[model samples]
Target: MKGRTVVLDHIQGREAAALMVDGILEDFLIASDAPPIGTIYRARADRPVKGQGGMFLTTPDGPAFLRQVKGLAPGVQLLVQVTGFAEPGKALPVTNRILFKSRYAIVTPDAPGLNISRSIRDEDERDRLLEIAHDQMQGCDYGLILRSCCHGADDADIAEDVSAMRAQAEQVMLDPGTEPETLCDGDAPHVLAWRDWTDPAEVATAAGSFETHGVLDALDVASGIVEPLPAGASLFIQPTRALVAVDVNTGSDTSLAAGTKANFACAKALPRALRVRGLGGQITLDLAPMPKKDRKGFESALRSAFKTDLDETILAGWTPLGHFELQRKRGRVPLAEVLK
Candidate 1:
């Protein structure tokens, strides 16, 4: 397994971090603009908007909206997790279904169940993890979902992580009087990008001013420097409100075979670009035109590349116009906006 490196570069006039996996830019982190996701809070339901099918809650950080009321009346207290941050005028999005995440697993306090990660394809490992969850959760009243990182982890380590998460969940339940505010601050973007997006033996961190690293150069390329690619191909990424669009153009070489190779190369690089830029939500890839029979192979290659994404990503198949559609779970603001 290749070790992932986290480079914190303050040269951009802000606290920016990048996740480099096997020398490829996997993700970017900006500490200034976006509010951390997964922050837990205990809030009081302000009022129910019967028409909107949701209720507003008051929290220490600010107001949050619960998309579903769930029969809770005004003034009823509820424990919620910060799902999304506030937009220009929108309130933060919160959910009653709380999940406490640890280094190896996620603990769901509102439900009691066990779910292995879909990324864990090995039946034996999945079964073993399930057994561990059952044994550890014997008397516990919370749910456990092993993260992808838990694959091949020792039983003792998994047990320890579960125990710690359960303790945190217990603390939250015991102290229901927590002021309507963020009870626990979420992990930093760098922490999340490393933990969720990469596989590494160890992670190292540094502070203060530092010299430019190769990751910085990758950032420059991603920001539109037209980095060189295989077979004289160049990639362009455009971020928009609706979705991120990627265009792959072959350099001067107008041969059909060259175009096909460039398109395939783009398939391999597009996922890394999306992750590196933290460009989540809808994504459309406009690759050079290829034969209809080759579409399946191209799509398969793209799917394999996206397997490393931290959040769930669905390839919605190619459109009639030959553009590929993809949807990724929205966890934070895009890095482009954050940098701006």
Candidate 2:
């Protein structure tokens, strides 16, 4: 099993929280004030502009835009989920597709039917999960999407999680009179990190603040301290707005064989670093040149390493200059902006 640990640090004198996994800084977010992503909000359609195909909404957090409105008129109240966070001079994006996330799965109250996770490639396991979901969904109007964590879970465990999510969805659906502009907050970033990246049962909390828990040291390592790898190797991670570029550098004293070994090691470690840094979107890896025949083996190893990531990641093949390109879905806020 891959050993994982989570650390939540309340940075002194800052209005943000830092999350570390396995002693590596992964996510940092503004505490409390950040826009709640999965929170369900009761909002009223303020005015529908005929020029635009959507309507404006007035929510408790503020105004939001509904890109599509089907016969929705002004002053119409409905339940909407926070789809995206608000940007500077921009409003949050809301959608009618409501979703409730539990420990093991996501429940879509208005979805057409049940859908299983695509990451579970094992045919037998997928079929088994589908059977379990079908059993739990009986008499329930909503649908469920089994998360990655549900891969090895028993039917009873899946049933319990689904039941809890069903209850939440039911309460929201029954409360059509919920006050407008009110929201039901979802899980926090740290909680989500722990749940998705590490086992909640294995989490150990420290009594003092982050400074006392060696979180700052981890942050320092993430910031710039490149750890020495086998054969005197190091990695330089450069993150830009377009993509993250990781450069593998070997010591001058390293032999050719040792350098190639280090390159392979770097390729294996790169994915974990990306996940811990929360560096999503496009990525490019520049490694020491190796034989053309060996490239395929290296790529295959990289693919295997990335499969462990919770978010969807796509390997876009190699470039003419021997740079490896990849794309990860922007499922969460970038660590750079979060820390800034």
Q: What are the per-residue Cα lDDT tens digits for candidate 2 across 189-244?
A: 56565446534433435644466545666665665526445666888888775678
* Whole-model lDDT values for every prediction: 0.75, 0.71
Please give the RMSD to the true structure for each candidate, in Å: 3.7, 5.3
Instruction: State the displacement of the C-alpha of residue 56, model 2, in Å, after optimal TM-score superposition.
Output: 9.7
- Roughly what TM-score does model 1 have, to 2 decimal places? 0.81
Residue 271, candidate 1: alpha-carbon lDDT: 67
- The ten-residue window of minimal lDDT in model 1 covers 204-213
Error of 2 at 131 (Å): 9.9
